[model samples]
Target: MRVTTFAAFRHRNYRLFFVGQLISMMGTWMQQTAIGWLIYQLTGSKLLLGTVQAIGGLPTFFLSTVGGAVADRFPKRAVLVLTQSVMMLAAFALGVLVSTGQIRVWQVAALTAMRGAVMAFDMPVRQAFVVDMVGRDDLMDAVGLNSSLVSGARIVGPAVAGLVMGRFGTAPCFYANAASFLAVIGGLVAMRLTPSPRMVSPESVLRHAVGGFVEVRRNPRVLGLMAILLTVGIFGWSYSVLLPVFARDVLGIAEQRYGLLLAANGVGALLGSLVIASLGDYPHWERLVTGGVFLFGVCLVLFSWTTRFHLALLFLALAGLGMISFHSTANTVIQTSVPDAVRGRVMGVWAMVFVGTHPLGSLLAGILAEHFGASLTVSMSASICVLVAVGVSLARKKGNGALRPNVTGSAGTAGQES
Candidate 1:
């Protein structure tokens, strides 16, 4: 797109942060690709694959709100640095266990859950930290570019991990992921930014955290978006856990080809993110988010019915486009609309809605896949997403209204503090 499409890169701190995050996210995706294959390869159980994913989501469900409160109470940079370091250690541990031939299904599950716990804290802080770096004006661009970076990583990580795991095995993927954290650590260290002014509350921690809940409840737009997000997270995202099954059992593709399937999805997501970036702080974010959800459901349904590998890849790519469009828009809208006072805690609830429900979906998907077959399970999930989108549309017609009319104009130039 235009150079203006990447205006967020004009800010030095955001540029540095973006580069570091890109590297780290690539590693994270590689680890995810390898882990899914490893779990399935070891257990040969679709249920267990879903179970591992469920385990990963469980901590986020339980602790993400508290994690958001922690983000508000503490320095986000310090929190992120600490969390990133712990995640690095966890990755190394997984590598060691896998490389030693000592890795078991249970160990993988436990480690996945542990990383999820760290992410419960890390996701909100990291997301909230974006505004601190770019401020309000470039917030939309920053969000879009960040998502593009993630989608870019998704492309590189899975394709490379597929080859890497196929050749050197899964351990190297974990080790590589562990080493990649250094980039993020370095970025955080190098950045120069003043601390953000918190809407510091006089209330107790519990009361302060609870106040975030109240803030969201008072905003109909945020409340409705959160409801839609929860539904999407629960039904729309669990296709990830089923990919290995889809590749092996449904499409009859080899393990090496699995990465290609995942990469195809990434390519679509990258395209969608770039389009969002090009839009550059557009006012009609609700349209983008809702439309994306509708397209995602349609693509997923198409993907479910496809037995041909090439066709499946095309459908998966379309689904990825829709998925990222919905997600990035929702993220930018909430971040820009909320007051900085409770941003962290509010984002914590956002994290809970966006990710917390995945555990439930993963568990349900697993059970459904075991009995109903992968194609039908995925098709059913896709149907739910379509229904959710339609439901949202109807609800909006009944006067739920747009997200924060005040946020409708161009972003203010004042950069948010650290």
Candidate 2:
């Protein structure tokens, strides 16, 4: 069972948190799909859609470190509760405005910024808490499982989101997202991890936050890892953002078919996650990140060129595999390398790069698509990814390339502890 990753379920806190988060993630994906459609409908400009998404994503890069500091120094449960509440309120407001026919492009941008601010705080704390629930030994399994759920929700949620948006309206999508936050809050309250001594009396917030940055820079391995992961974020993982374009332009599909396009990628990601979880340990970090990310870039480029929808779908799955491989491995490395004191802050930076940097790719792709074409823009993005991967790979050194997998029994340890 321990080898199976079901071992993490023996812990009461993780069990509840995982189940609740699974529901909330599904709703969040549903809302995300709806937002893109709603914004596209209202503005009728690809640039504006790009702008709206850029607004939502930009704040995470700025505020995540502060959020991480709070996570490391305070009770993660309290931090999560506060952030989730803020998110719920923002969702409710969006629903109300859209429902009343008063919503504008600016309003969507503003509200999305609000939610993004909340998420900046939420991501690090949530990631940091994984160790608390399962310990370092199980971190890989937990991370894999966590990643799996996100992919699972992506697979199922979009299909449901498209249907709801098509049948009902966008308001319900917003409301559902707001309601999902409660599930996360409930799980946080049920957790049972003890805070460290350093975590208490956290007065020097600035100093503590800076510490994480200093530490990451000081560690050659981690700095290299960040560089590798940055490529993955900026290029490899833009599939979800590009999905709407693929559905409308390349495949010439409607709502359900659009949903299936995402479904194929999600299914692939889910399978990737399950593979990582069953590995029972982290693989060679450098090789996995670089190779996986390289494959993603290659697949995206290949998929962009294909006219056949079925063939594109196959390539998308390959892209998903590479994307998840990059994600799962990078996560394992970062969590393992950092000390507990600054773990949250380090993971915050990870979230910033892995997710926050995506807006740049999205915005660039949108602009290029508007000027040239969607296919060319996607191809350009893939080209950049290839360059990044090759450049980073050549510069990378050994030992830092593929550290041994650490699978100690304790969940409290970082994956690097092996």
Candidate 3:
């Protein structure tokens, strides 16, 4: 049997979507990098940074399930277009505020919250939209490529942000992000997506939303995976929220150098995504998830302790590699294992755990950084992730088959991807 990395690209619609994502994600990263730096530079309050970040994510936590329900009920392309348009306007507004010297921390936080709310709906719909584009035969490969696209953007966005912020100002990054959305909108408009099979319920929206929870309850594998994602998303992946602190106070680096640190992480993440793509539907996704989680935690631990800038870069890169591998495998497993009727709902739950947990982690990290210092706060968080991995591994050893997905779904299965 042979496995192909670019299998999903056989579909023209997916190809267009992928290209659009490649452009938009870079701009998103640019805005993220600029915003973090701008906040830290203005206030130098770790807790405030965390607070703003948390505020943004709060909507995703509560509304993602509803967003999933909307995806299941409506056309994903339309949902995506609406969400993306709103996000673009938000980004442009932020840029205007910053450029006019009218931007306040409260304003930034408010806009961030608005963006997060839009993402709450957009993420699940976009995630479900992938299946509509390529079906199940190439899901894993497409997922890998998608991860690669994100990391590839990470590599470019931060670099550009650093340069632009260092020379002109943070406003430019925001403006660039706003303009980038046009590309995504164009791609979406150009797509000729076949209508996906819809899940209909003659019940209240609340009842329909609750059904997503019930689906996860019935699947032990998905339950365990979501638990893992929550742990990692909060304690593990939130290390990024602290990177600005790490670069400024700890490593004593300039904004450009800080961007380099981010780019280095992207370099490793890109490699990780490519490696997953090359694996070509490997069977033991559990091992990949566990190993990646453990490695990510360990790398963060090392990164926090390391005083040298170069060494810290290496650790961050390794952390990125581990993070992407863990997430991509987990995403593919969830998408392929669940029934088509509930795929959007489950993905919404997945997005909730994956992204919604970040606010709590950011808040915790910010508070800890203020009291204990950024280095120690990050170190403690990483340690918690390591413990979570160990606990889950031990629990699974005792006869729970939750580590592996069953791969029985209406659209297709993970096993079929191979």
Candidate 4:
């Protein structure tokens, strides 16, 4: 039977989740664009830009494992509702502060940290919840579609935010984001889901969290993927922290045009996600993962060197494409390979390496940008990413059999548990 690119949409629960999340994520990207612009406008400091982004990642770096443990012990939907509500409140608070002209850097940093703490829980549960919604047969398609949803938001959110910010100021962007949460919260409440079996254990939460690490250690392919994510997370992903600097200083663009630059990246990412969704059943996962990363790194390098606005946008779009391609494939592979019992915990580790490492990368990027300038800093980081991708590809060719999908861990029965 031929699988459709939109197979996941056939499931009612996933459809609701997708539509709701699409709305919420657009709000999220709007807030993100506003925050970055706000910080840059206030401080005019590249290091602070990186520092603020790093502040947000610190909580996720430290607490995502514990959050994963919570996911295993409780219902994911309830947890999501709670996290979404908290995030809504945070956005509301930010909106109030900005609207009142009382917003300060410290306040923004604190709220960013708050949201990050909530994400530490939300991300792992949400990722593991995909299989619960669509079952194993459509897991890969679901993952790809989710990526497309996020990328789609990235496309619309920033463009809309730019127009709003240009006309009304950043406060409205925050308010709009605050209101967007209602769609997702409502969807979560409306879903008809079976109760996820709680992993009752005599172990402490720390021990349960550690179990995820143990599982990754036992699986070589998962371990290798984690390592690759670490490199990409730290060096490759951190490049975004410099986008504001790049836009204003290098590309000589204004606030509105900067949003367009981000939208360009989103367009590429959206296309990439659609490609992945269409090829959900493809066998050669390794090639897609490595090739995507190499393409991203190369485009990022070229992007950093470009002074022309259109040229920079072109490179940014290609980089975005490569990024989503690598991320969506790797995520699907890892989720499908792990046992359902430990999926949340394993995803916690994934969050730790992927999301947690962002701060370190941001700090590094900020420092380098402060000293060497944004263009050179980005070029250097992109070079490291390119080199890492090449190294991983070479190692795989040298008989690293563990990188292939494991038959024993196949999603058939392993994904169906509770």
lDDT of 1: 0.85
Give the number of the best model, judged by lDDT. 4
| lDDT of residue 214 for candidate 2 | 85
lDDT of 1 by residue, 1-418 (tens): 1226788888887888899999999999999999999999999998998999999889998788888888778877888899999999999999999999999988998988999999989998888888777767677788889989999999999999999988999999999999999999999888876655555667776677776688789877778789889889889887888999998898998757899999999999999999998886465667777789999999999999899999998998999999999988888878766787677888989988889899999998999999998889989898899988887777666764585323444443333444
Query: By how many angstroms RMSD does model 2 differ from the true structure?
Result: 3.3
List the candidate 4 regions with Cα displacement exceeding 4 Å: 1-3, 406-418
lDDT of 2 by residue, 196-315 (tens): 554564568766777778878986667777876676666655555666777776777766666666667778888888887777643445666777778888888888878788888788
* TM-score per candidate, chains pooled: 0.95, 0.91, 0.96, 0.97
Clashing pairs in 3: none
Error of 2 at 44 (Å): 2.4
Candidate 4, residues 1-418: lDDT per residue as tens digits?
2447888888788888999999999999999989999999889999999999999999999999888887777888889999999999999999999999999999999999999999999999999888888877787788889999999998899989888888888998898899999999999888877654567899998888998898899988899899999999999976688888987899888778888888889999999999999984676779888999999999999999999999988998999999999999889878878887888999999999999999999999999999999988989999998999899888888965455443345453212223
Candidate 3 per-residue C-alpha lDDT over 1-418 given as tens digits, one digit per residue, 9 for 90 to 100:
3458789898888898999999999999999999999889889999998989999999999999989888788877888899999999999999999999999999999999999999999998888888778777777788899999999999999998998898999999999999999999999899865554555679776668777889988987888889889888788856789899998888898889888889889988999999998887576777788888888899999999887999998998998999898999899888877888788888889889999989999999899998999889889899888888777777766864556644445663221110
Off by over 4 Å in 1: 1-4, 196-202, 397-401, 404-417
Global CA lDDT of candidate 2, please?
A: 0.76
lDDT of 4 at 211: 81
Cα-based lDDT at residue 145, candidate 2: 89
The order by descending TM-score is: 4, 3, 1, 2
Every candidate's lDDT: 0.85, 0.76, 0.86, 0.88
Displacement of residue 263 (Cα, Å) in model 1 is 0.7
Query: Candidate 3's error at 233, in angstroms?
Result: 1.9
